[model samples]
Target: MALLSVHNLSQSFGGLQALTDFNMEIGGYDLVGLIGPNGAGKTTVFNLVSGFYTPTRGAIVFNGKPTRGMKPHEVTALGLARTFQNIRLWNDLSVLDNIRIAQYHRLGYGFLDAVLRTARYARAEKNVDRKCRDILDMMDLTEFVEELPKNLPYGLQRRVELARALSTKPRLLLLDEPAAGLNALDVDGLIHLIRWIYNEFKISIWMIEHQMKVVMTLCQRLMVMDFGKTIADGAPGEIQNNPDVIAAYLGDGAV
Candidate 1:
Protein backbone atom coordinates (compact mmCIF):
# COMPACT_ATOMS: atom_id res chain seq x y z
CA MET A 1 0.00 0.00 0.00
CA ALA A 2 1.09 3.57 -0.52
CA LEU A 3 2.59 5.30 2.47
CA LEU A 4 0.74 8.50 1.64
CA SER A 5 -2.13 9.20 -0.74
CA VAL A 6 -3.85 12.50 -1.43
CA HIS A 7 -6.91 12.69 -3.64
CA ASN A 8 -8.50 15.77 -5.10
CA LEU A 9 -6.94 17.93 -2.39
CA SER A 10 -7.76 21.62 -2.46
CA GLN A 11 -7.20 24.58 -0.14
CA SER A 12 -8.23 28.22 -0.24
CA PHE A 13 -7.74 31.29 1.90
CA GLY A 14 -10.42 33.95 1.58
CA GLY A 15 -10.65 34.51 -2.18
CA LEU A 16 -7.25 33.06 -3.00
CA GLN A 17 -7.07 29.41 -3.99
CA ALA A 18 -3.70 28.14 -2.88
CA LEU A 19 -4.00 24.59 -4.19
CA THR A 20 -6.44 22.89 -6.52
CA ASP A 21 -6.96 19.17 -6.91
CA PHE A 22 -3.46 18.28 -5.76
CA ASN A 23 -3.11 14.52 -6.00
CA MET A 24 -0.13 12.43 -4.99
CA GLU A 25 0.76 8.86 -4.00
CA ILE A 26 4.05 8.12 -2.29
CA GLY A 27 5.25 4.57 -2.01
CA GLY A 28 7.07 2.95 0.90
CA TYR A 29 10.62 4.08 0.21
CA ASP A 30 10.28 6.69 -2.45
CA LEU A 31 12.33 9.88 -2.66
CA VAL A 32 10.27 12.51 -4.46
CA GLY A 33 10.64 16.21 -5.06
CA LEU A 34 8.07 18.99 -5.45
CA ILE A 35 9.25 22.11 -7.28
CA GLY A 36 7.76 25.21 -8.83
CA PRO A 37 8.00 28.97 -9.06
CA ASN A 38 7.70 31.11 -5.91
CA GLY A 39 3.90 31.22 -5.64
CA ALA A 40 3.17 27.84 -7.14
CA GLY A 41 1.65 26.58 -3.84
CA LYS A 42 4.31 23.97 -3.18
CA THR A 43 4.44 24.74 0.55
CA THR A 44 0.65 24.89 0.56
CA VAL A 45 0.55 21.23 -0.43
CA PHE A 46 2.94 20.33 2.37
CA ASN A 47 0.88 22.33 4.81
CA LEU A 48 -2.26 20.48 3.84
CA VAL A 49 -0.65 17.07 3.95
CA SER A 50 0.99 17.73 7.30
CA GLY A 51 -2.33 18.90 8.81
CA PHE A 52 -1.23 22.45 9.49
CA TYR A 53 -4.22 23.55 7.40
CA THR A 54 -7.48 21.75 6.87
CA PRO A 55 -8.16 21.09 3.20
CA THR A 56 -11.22 22.72 1.74
CA ARG A 57 -11.95 19.59 -0.29
CA GLY A 58 -10.82 15.98 -0.79
CA ALA A 59 -9.08 13.49 1.47
CA ILE A 60 -5.67 12.33 2.67
CA VAL A 61 -4.90 8.74 3.63
CA PHE A 62 -1.64 8.09 5.41
CA ASN A 63 -0.48 4.67 6.50
CA GLY A 64 -3.99 3.40 5.64
CA LYS A 65 -5.74 5.92 7.91
CA PRO A 66 -7.71 9.00 6.88
CA THR A 67 -6.14 12.26 8.06
CA ARG A 68 -9.07 14.61 7.56
CA GLY A 69 -9.68 16.96 10.50
CA MET A 70 -6.57 15.74 12.28
CA LYS A 71 -4.37 18.26 14.04
CA PRO A 72 -0.70 18.67 13.16
CA HIS A 73 0.42 16.68 16.18
CA GLU A 74 -2.15 14.02 15.40
CA VAL A 75 -0.81 13.68 11.89
CA THR A 76 2.71 13.58 13.28
CA ALA A 77 1.71 10.76 15.60
CA LEU A 78 0.46 8.87 12.60
CA GLY A 79 4.04 8.44 11.38
CA LEU A 80 4.50 11.70 9.49
CA ALA A 81 7.03 14.37 10.46
CA ARG A 82 8.29 17.49 8.70
CA THR A 83 10.82 20.31 8.85
CA PHE A 84 9.99 23.87 7.85
CA GLN A 85 11.18 26.14 5.05
CA ASN A 86 12.37 28.50 7.74
CA ILE A 87 14.12 26.75 10.61
CA ARG A 88 11.73 26.19 13.54
CA LEU A 89 14.10 24.88 16.15
CA TRP A 90 13.75 26.04 19.72
CA ASN A 91 16.49 28.65 19.72
CA ASP A 92 16.61 29.01 23.49
CA LEU A 93 16.85 25.30 24.21
CA SER A 94 19.96 23.19 24.07
CA VAL A 95 20.18 21.00 20.99
CA LEU A 96 19.69 17.93 23.15
CA ASP A 97 16.62 19.43 24.75
CA ASN A 98 15.16 20.24 21.37
CA ILE A 99 15.54 16.69 20.16
CA ARG A 100 14.33 15.30 23.49
CA ILE A 101 11.10 17.27 23.25
CA ALA A 102 10.08 15.90 19.86
CA GLN A 103 9.64 12.44 21.35
CA TYR A 104 7.26 13.59 24.09
CA HIS A 105 4.24 12.75 22.01
CA ARG A 106 5.25 9.11 22.26
CA LEU A 107 6.83 9.14 25.67
CA GLY A 108 4.19 6.70 26.98
CA TYR A 109 3.79 8.48 30.29
CA GLY A 110 0.81 10.44 31.48
CA PHE A 111 0.63 13.63 33.57
CA LEU A 112 -0.02 11.70 36.77
CA ASP A 113 2.95 9.49 36.12
CA ALA A 114 5.14 12.50 35.50
CA VAL A 115 3.77 14.46 38.47
CA LEU A 116 4.54 11.59 40.81
CA ARG A 117 7.81 10.70 39.10
CA THR A 118 6.73 7.12 38.57
CA ALA A 119 9.01 4.38 37.29
CA ARG A 120 7.27 4.51 33.92
CA TYR A 121 8.12 8.17 33.58
CA ALA A 122 11.66 7.56 34.60
CA ARG A 123 12.13 4.76 32.08
CA ALA A 124 10.48 6.77 29.32
CA GLU A 125 12.65 9.78 30.01
CA LYS A 126 15.79 7.68 30.08
CA ASN A 127 14.85 6.01 26.81
CA VAL A 128 14.15 9.35 25.20
CA ASP A 129 17.53 10.65 26.30
CA ARG A 130 19.35 7.65 24.88
CA LYS A 131 17.44 7.84 21.62
CA CYS A 132 18.10 11.54 21.29
CA ARG A 133 21.79 10.97 21.85
CA ASP A 134 21.82 8.18 19.25
CA ILE A 135 20.02 10.35 16.71
CA LEU A 136 22.38 13.28 17.27
CA ASP A 137 25.32 10.94 16.90
CA MET A 138 23.92 9.53 13.70
CA MET A 139 23.45 13.03 12.34
CA ASP A 140 27.00 14.03 13.33
CA LEU A 141 25.61 16.48 15.87
CA THR A 142 26.76 14.89 19.13
CA GLU A 143 29.51 17.45 19.67
CA PHE A 144 26.97 20.26 19.79
CA VAL A 145 24.53 18.64 22.19
CA GLU A 146 24.92 21.32 24.83
CA GLU A 147 24.92 24.23 22.41
CA LEU A 148 21.87 26.39 21.72
CA PRO A 149 20.38 26.20 18.24
CA LYS A 150 20.90 29.94 17.75
CA ASN A 151 24.59 29.48 18.40
CA LEU A 152 25.10 26.96 15.60
CA PRO A 153 25.88 27.88 12.02
CA TYR A 154 22.98 27.90 9.58
CA GLY A 155 23.93 24.54 8.05
CA LEU A 156 24.30 22.86 11.45
CA GLN A 157 20.99 24.35 12.56
CA ARG A 158 19.43 22.72 9.54
CA ARG A 159 20.93 19.40 10.58
CA VAL A 160 19.60 19.83 14.09
CA GLU A 161 16.08 20.36 12.69
CA LEU A 162 16.44 17.25 10.56
CA ALA A 163 17.65 15.29 13.58
CA ARG A 164 14.70 16.44 15.65
CA ALA A 165 12.26 15.30 12.99
CA LEU A 166 13.90 11.91 12.78
CA SER A 167 13.62 11.57 16.55
CA THR A 168 9.91 11.12 16.02
CA LYS A 169 10.60 7.87 14.16
CA PRO A 170 8.43 8.93 11.25
CA ARG A 171 7.61 6.60 8.41
CA LEU A 172 7.46 9.49 5.98
CA LEU A 173 9.72 12.54 6.28
CA LEU A 174 8.80 15.86 4.71
CA LEU A 175 11.66 18.29 4.22
CA ASP A 176 10.79 21.82 3.16
CA GLU A 177 13.59 23.89 1.61
CA PRO A 178 16.30 22.16 3.65
CA ALA A 179 19.01 23.73 1.54
CA ALA A 180 17.56 27.21 1.63
CA GLY A 181 20.43 29.14 3.24
CA LEU A 182 23.34 26.83 2.59
CA ASN A 183 26.46 27.70 0.61
CA ALA A 184 27.56 25.49 -2.29
CA LEU A 185 29.53 23.11 -0.06
CA ASP A 186 26.73 22.86 2.45
CA VAL A 187 24.25 22.18 -0.32
CA ASP A 188 26.41 19.33 -1.54
CA GLY A 189 26.64 17.99 2.00
CA LEU A 190 22.86 18.21 2.35
CA ILE A 191 22.41 16.12 -0.78
CA HIS A 192 24.62 13.42 0.63
CA LEU A 193 22.99 13.60 4.05
CA ILE A 194 19.50 13.25 2.63
CA ARG A 195 20.57 10.29 0.53
CA TRP A 196 22.17 8.72 3.55
CA ILE A 197 19.08 9.24 5.67
CA TYR A 198 16.84 7.62 3.08
CA ASN A 199 19.11 4.63 2.70
CA GLU A 200 19.86 4.25 6.39
CA PHE A 201 16.31 4.51 7.65
CA LYS A 202 14.59 2.99 4.61
CA ILE A 203 11.82 5.56 4.88
CA SER A 204 10.03 7.70 2.31
CA ILE A 205 11.11 11.32 1.79
CA TRP A 206 9.10 14.04 0.05
CA MET A 207 10.80 17.42 -0.26
CA ILE A 208 9.84 20.85 -1.52
CA GLU A 209 13.02 22.50 -2.69
CA HIS A 210 13.69 25.46 -4.98
CA GLN A 211 17.28 24.61 -5.79
CA MET A 212 17.48 22.72 -9.05
CA LYS A 213 20.79 21.08 -8.18
CA VAL A 214 19.44 19.71 -4.90
CA VAL A 215 16.26 18.32 -6.45
CA MET A 216 17.93 17.00 -9.59
CA THR A 217 20.63 15.27 -7.62
CA LEU A 218 18.51 13.73 -4.83
CA CYS A 219 15.02 13.19 -6.16
CA GLN A 220 13.94 10.04 -7.93
CA ARG A 221 10.83 11.73 -9.32
CA LEU A 222 9.86 15.38 -9.61
CA MET A 223 6.46 17.07 -9.50
CA VAL A 224 6.10 20.61 -10.77
CA MET A 225 3.30 22.99 -9.96
CA ASP A 226 2.29 26.48 -11.07
CA PHE A 227 -0.50 28.82 -10.05
CA GLY A 228 -1.92 26.26 -7.62
CA LYS A 229 -2.00 23.49 -10.21
CA THR A 230 0.23 20.63 -11.20
CA ILE A 231 1.93 21.14 -14.53
CA ALA A 232 4.17 18.11 -14.75
CA ASP A 233 5.28 14.93 -12.96
CA GLY A 234 8.02 12.61 -14.12
CA ALA A 235 11.56 11.32 -13.60
CA PRO A 236 14.23 13.91 -12.88
CA GLY A 237 15.70 13.90 -16.38
CA GLU A 238 12.28 14.13 -18.00
CA ILE A 239 11.21 16.96 -15.72
CA GLN A 240 14.41 18.83 -16.51
CA ASN A 241 13.50 18.72 -20.19
CA ASN A 242 9.70 19.10 -19.91
CA PRO A 243 8.49 22.09 -21.83
CA ASP A 244 5.74 22.87 -19.31
CA VAL A 245 8.17 22.79 -16.40
CA ILE A 246 10.76 24.75 -18.35
CA ALA A 247 8.15 27.33 -19.26
CA ALA A 248 6.95 27.54 -15.69
CA TYR A 249 10.46 28.15 -14.34
CA LEU A 250 11.76 30.18 -17.26
CA GLY A 251 9.21 31.59 -19.70
CA ASP A 252 7.33 30.60 -22.80
CA GLY A 253 10.11 32.18 -24.82
CA ALA A 254 12.68 29.91 -23.21
CA VAL A 255 10.59 26.82 -23.80
Candidate 2:
Protein backbone atom coordinates (compact mmCIF):
# COMPACT_ATOMS: atom_id res chain seq x y z
CA MET A 1 0.00 0.00 0.00
CA ALA A 2 1.04 3.58 -0.61
CA LEU A 3 2.33 5.53 2.36
CA LEU A 4 -0.36 8.15 1.79
CA SER A 5 -3.50 7.92 -0.32
CA VAL A 6 -6.28 10.34 -1.15
CA HIS A 7 -9.21 8.94 -3.04
CA ASN A 8 -11.79 11.35 -4.51
CA LEU A 9 -10.95 13.99 -1.93
CA SER A 10 -12.95 17.20 -2.11
CA GLN A 11 -13.27 20.37 -0.02
CA SER A 12 -15.74 23.22 -0.08
CA PHE A 13 -15.68 26.49 1.80
CA GLY A 14 -19.37 27.40 1.86
CA GLY A 15 -20.32 27.66 -1.80
CA LEU A 16 -16.80 27.79 -3.17
CA GLN A 17 -15.30 24.44 -4.00
CA ALA A 18 -11.58 24.47 -3.34
CA LEU A 19 -10.88 20.85 -4.26
CA THR A 20 -12.79 18.37 -6.37
CA ASP A 21 -12.37 14.63 -6.54
CA PHE A 22 -8.63 14.87 -6.03
CA ASN A 23 -6.80 11.55 -5.92
CA MET A 24 -3.15 10.83 -5.19
CA GLU A 25 -0.92 8.09 -3.81
CA ILE A 26 2.52 8.62 -2.31
CA GLY A 27 4.70 5.61 -1.68
CA GLY A 28 7.34 5.30 1.00
CA TYR A 29 10.41 7.47 0.36
CA ASP A 30 8.76 9.07 -2.68
CA LEU A 31 9.30 12.73 -3.52
CA VAL A 32 6.15 14.09 -5.19
CA GLY A 33 5.48 17.66 -6.26
CA LEU A 34 2.12 19.39 -6.59
CA ILE A 35 2.11 22.57 -8.67
CA GLY A 36 -0.41 24.91 -10.21
CA PRO A 37 -1.45 28.55 -10.55
CA ASN A 38 -2.69 30.49 -7.53
CA GLY A 39 -6.10 29.40 -6.14
CA ALA A 40 -5.62 25.98 -7.69
CA GLY A 41 -6.18 24.18 -4.32
CA LYS A 42 -2.60 22.93 -3.93
CA THR A 43 -2.42 24.27 -0.39
CA THR A 44 -5.90 22.96 0.25
CA VAL A 45 -4.65 19.49 -0.55
CA PHE A 46 -1.83 19.87 1.96
CA ASN A 47 -4.20 21.20 4.58
CA LEU A 48 -6.59 18.32 4.06
CA VAL A 49 -3.91 15.65 4.08
CA SER A 50 -2.25 17.04 7.19
CA GLY A 51 -5.62 17.32 8.97
CA PHE A 52 -5.57 21.09 9.24
CA TYR A 53 -8.96 20.93 7.54
CA THR A 54 -11.21 17.92 7.24
CA PRO A 55 -12.33 17.16 3.74
CA THR A 56 -15.86 17.89 2.63
CA ARG A 57 -15.96 14.54 0.79
CA GLY A 58 -14.00 11.33 0.18
CA ALA A 59 -11.24 9.93 2.36
CA ILE A 60 -7.53 10.13 3.18
CA VAL A 61 -5.63 7.04 4.31
CA PHE A 62 -2.15 7.22 5.80
CA ASN A 63 -0.22 4.10 6.74
CA GLY A 64 -3.36 1.94 6.34
CA LYS A 65 -5.57 4.04 8.66
CA PRO A 66 -8.36 6.46 7.74
CA THR A 67 -7.91 10.16 8.53
CA ARG A 68 -11.48 11.36 8.30
CA GLY A 69 -11.74 13.46 11.46
CA MET A 70 -8.27 13.44 12.98
CA LYS A 71 -6.95 16.70 14.42
CA PRO A 72 -3.64 18.21 13.34
CA HIS A 73 -1.84 16.95 16.44
CA GLU A 74 -3.41 13.56 16.03
CA VAL A 75 -2.10 13.38 12.50
CA THR A 76 1.33 14.44 13.70
CA ALA A 77 1.30 11.63 16.23
CA LEU A 78 0.62 9.26 13.37
CA GLY A 79 3.94 10.36 11.78
CA LEU A 80 2.92 13.07 9.31
CA ALA A 81 4.25 16.62 9.57
CA ARG A 82 4.17 19.74 7.40
CA THR A 83 5.59 23.26 6.96
CA PHE A 84 3.58 26.15 5.59
CA GLN A 85 3.57 28.28 2.44
CA ASN A 86 3.77 31.25 4.74
CA ILE A 87 6.48 30.89 7.38
CA ARG A 88 4.50 29.75 10.43
CA LEU A 89 7.25 29.76 12.99
CA TRP A 90 6.51 31.32 16.36
CA ASN A 91 8.23 34.66 15.89
CA ASP A 92 8.62 35.48 19.60
CA LEU A 93 9.98 32.10 20.65
CA SER A 94 13.61 31.01 20.47
CA VAL A 95 14.38 28.74 17.50
CA LEU A 96 15.27 25.88 19.84
CA ASP A 97 11.97 26.11 21.70
CA ASN A 98 10.04 26.21 18.45
CA ILE A 99 11.57 22.93 17.35
CA ARG A 100 11.21 21.40 20.81
CA ILE A 101 7.50 22.22 20.92
CA ALA A 102 6.92 20.09 17.85
CA GLN A 103 8.21 17.13 19.82
CA TYR A 104 5.41 17.31 22.41
CA HIS A 105 3.86 14.03 21.37
CA ARG A 106 7.19 12.30 21.61
CA LEU A 107 7.84 13.47 25.15
CA GLY A 108 5.37 10.89 26.52
CA TYR A 109 5.07 12.53 29.91
CA GLY A 110 1.97 14.16 31.38
CA PHE A 111 1.53 17.48 33.20
CA LEU A 112 1.60 15.65 36.56
CA ASP A 113 4.95 14.15 35.62
CA ALA A 114 6.14 17.62 34.69
CA VAL A 115 4.88 19.06 38.01
CA LEU A 116 6.68 16.34 39.96
CA ARG A 117 9.76 16.48 37.69
CA THR A 118 9.89 12.71 37.61
CA ALA A 119 12.82 10.79 36.16
CA ARG A 120 10.76 10.03 33.05
CA TYR A 121 10.03 13.71 32.55
CA ALA A 122 13.65 14.63 33.07
CA ARG A 123 14.84 12.01 30.64
CA ALA A 124 12.23 13.03 28.05
CA GLU A 125 13.12 16.71 28.35
CA LYS A 126 16.82 16.00 27.94
CA ASN A 127 16.19 13.77 24.96
CA VAL A 128 13.97 16.40 23.32
CA ASP A 129 16.57 19.12 23.90
CA ARG A 130 19.32 16.97 22.44
CA LYS A 131 17.20 16.07 19.41
CA CYS A 132 16.24 19.69 18.76
CA ARG A 133 19.86 20.77 19.00
CA ASP A 134 20.93 18.03 16.63
CA ILE A 135 18.27 19.07 14.13
CA LEU A 136 19.38 22.71 14.38
CA ASP A 137 22.96 21.64 13.78
CA MET A 138 21.90 19.66 10.71
CA MET A 139 20.00 22.65 9.32
CA ASP A 140 23.00 24.90 10.10
CA LEU A 141 20.83 27.04 12.38
CA THR A 142 22.74 26.12 15.54
CA GLU A 143 24.19 29.61 15.89
CA PHE A 144 20.73 31.14 16.04
CA VAL A 145 19.21 28.46 18.28
CA GLU A 146 18.64 30.93 21.11
CA GLU A 147 17.46 33.75 18.85
CA LEU A 148 13.91 34.56 17.87
CA PRO A 149 12.86 33.52 14.38
CA LYS A 150 11.92 37.10 13.44
CA ASN A 151 15.56 38.13 13.94
CA LEU A 152 16.91 35.58 11.47
CA PRO A 153 17.41 35.89 7.72
CA TYR A 154 14.52 34.72 5.53
CA GLY A 155 16.33 31.62 4.33
CA LEU A 156 17.33 30.69 7.86
CA GLN A 157 13.79 31.26 9.09
CA ARG A 158 12.65 28.81 6.44
CA ARG A 159 15.19 26.33 7.72
CA VAL A 160 13.85 26.72 11.25
CA GLU A 161 10.35 25.86 10.06
CA LEU A 162 11.64 22.83 8.19
CA ALA A 163 13.63 21.78 11.25
CA ARG A 164 10.58 22.07 13.45
CA ALA A 165 8.62 19.89 11.05
CA LEU A 166 11.35 17.28 11.13
CA SER A 167 11.53 17.39 14.94
CA THR A 168 8.42 15.27 15.03
CA LYS A 169 10.34 12.41 13.36
CA PRO A 170 7.63 12.05 10.77
CA ARG A 171 7.47 9.25 8.24
CA LEU A 172 5.88 11.60 5.71
CA LEU A 173 6.73 15.30 5.33
CA LEU A 174 4.64 17.93 3.58
CA LEU A 175 6.46 21.08 2.51
CA ASP A 176 4.41 23.98 1.21
CA GLU A 177 6.37 26.41 -0.93
CA PRO A 178 9.76 25.95 0.75
CA ALA A 179 11.27 27.95 -2.12
CA ALA A 180 9.07 30.98 -1.57
CA GLY A 181 10.84 34.29 -0.87
CA LEU A 182 14.25 32.78 -1.61
CA ASN A 183 16.88 34.26 -3.91
CA ALA A 184 18.71 32.20 -6.51
CA LEU A 185 21.44 31.10 -4.12
CA ASP A 186 19.00 30.35 -1.31
CA VAL A 187 16.79 28.34 -3.63
CA ASP A 188 19.78 26.31 -4.75
CA GLY A 189 20.68 25.68 -1.14
CA LEU A 190 17.11 24.63 -0.39
CA ILE A 191 17.16 22.14 -3.25
CA HIS A 192 20.35 20.59 -1.92
CA LEU A 193 19.01 20.55 1.63
CA ILE A 194 15.77 18.87 0.54
CA ARG A 195 17.77 16.24 -1.31
CA TRP A 196 19.85 15.70 1.79
CA ILE A 197 16.75 15.34 3.95
CA TYR A 198 15.34 12.72 1.60
CA ASN A 199 18.60 10.78 1.62
CA GLU A 200 18.91 10.96 5.38
CA PHE A 201 15.34 10.39 6.53
CA LYS A 202 14.13 8.12 3.74
CA ILE A 203 10.62 9.59 4.19
CA SER A 204 8.00 10.50 1.65
CA ILE A 205 7.94 14.23 0.76
CA TRP A 206 4.90 15.85 -0.82
CA MET A 207 5.48 19.47 -1.66
CA ILE A 208 3.56 22.34 -3.21
CA GLU A 209 5.95 24.55 -5.13
CA HIS A 210 5.50 27.46 -7.52
CA GLN A 211 9.12 27.63 -8.56
CA MET A 212 9.41 25.40 -11.62
CA LYS A 213 13.18 25.09 -11.21
CA VAL A 214 12.76 23.77 -7.66
CA VAL A 215 10.00 21.38 -8.68
CA MET A 216 11.77 19.98 -11.71
CA THR A 217 15.01 19.60 -9.82
CA LEU A 218 13.62 18.02 -6.63
CA CYS A 219 10.48 16.05 -7.49
CA GLN A 220 10.54 12.58 -9.01
CA ARG A 221 6.89 12.82 -10.10
CA LEU A 222 4.80 15.96 -10.65
CA MET A 223 1.06 16.50 -10.36
CA VAL A 224 -0.49 19.59 -11.91
CA MET A 225 -3.76 21.03 -10.64
CA ASP A 226 -5.92 23.89 -11.87
CA PHE A 227 -9.36 25.12 -10.88
CA GLY A 228 -9.67 22.40 -8.21
CA LYS A 229 -8.88 19.55 -10.61
CA THR A 230 -5.78 17.67 -11.66
CA ILE A 231 -4.60 18.54 -15.14
CA ALA A 232 -1.67 16.18 -15.27
CA ASP A 233 0.37 13.69 -13.24
CA GLY A 234 3.62 12.22 -14.55
CA ALA A 235 7.38 12.31 -14.42
CA PRO A 236 8.88 15.81 -14.55
CA GLY A 237 10.06 15.38 -18.15
CA GLU A 238 6.65 14.18 -19.25
CA ILE A 239 4.78 16.83 -17.22
CA GLN A 240 6.91 19.58 -18.75
CA ASN A 241 5.87 18.44 -22.21
CA ASN A 242 2.23 17.65 -21.45
CA PRO A 243 -0.22 19.57 -23.64
CA ASP A 244 -2.87 19.99 -20.92
CA VAL A 245 -0.29 21.18 -18.45
CA ILE A 246 1.04 23.66 -20.99
CA ALA A 247 -2.46 24.96 -21.68
CA ALA A 248 -3.50 25.19 -18.05
CA TYR A 249 -0.35 25.95 -16.08
CA LEU A 250 3.06 25.70 -17.74
CA GLY A 251 2.59 27.85 -20.76
CA ASP A 252 4.10 27.14 -24.18
CA GLY A 253 7.00 29.36 -23.13
CA ALA A 254 7.89 26.81 -20.45
CA VAL A 255 8.79 24.37 -23.20
User: Which tens-of-lDDT digit does each residue in 1-255 have in candidate 2?
Assistant: 899999999999999999999999999989999999999999999999989898999999998889989998989999999999889999999999999999998899999999999999999999998998889888888899899999999999999999999999999999999999999999999999999999998999999999999999999999999999998999999998888888786455765
- As for candidate 1, its clashing pairs are none
The C-alpha TM-scores of every prediction are 0.98, 0.97
- CA lDDT, every model vs. true structure: 0.95, 0.93
Candidate 1 overall Cα lDDT vs. reference?
Answer: 0.95
Off by over 4 Å in 2: 250-255
List clash counts for every candidate, in order: 0, 0
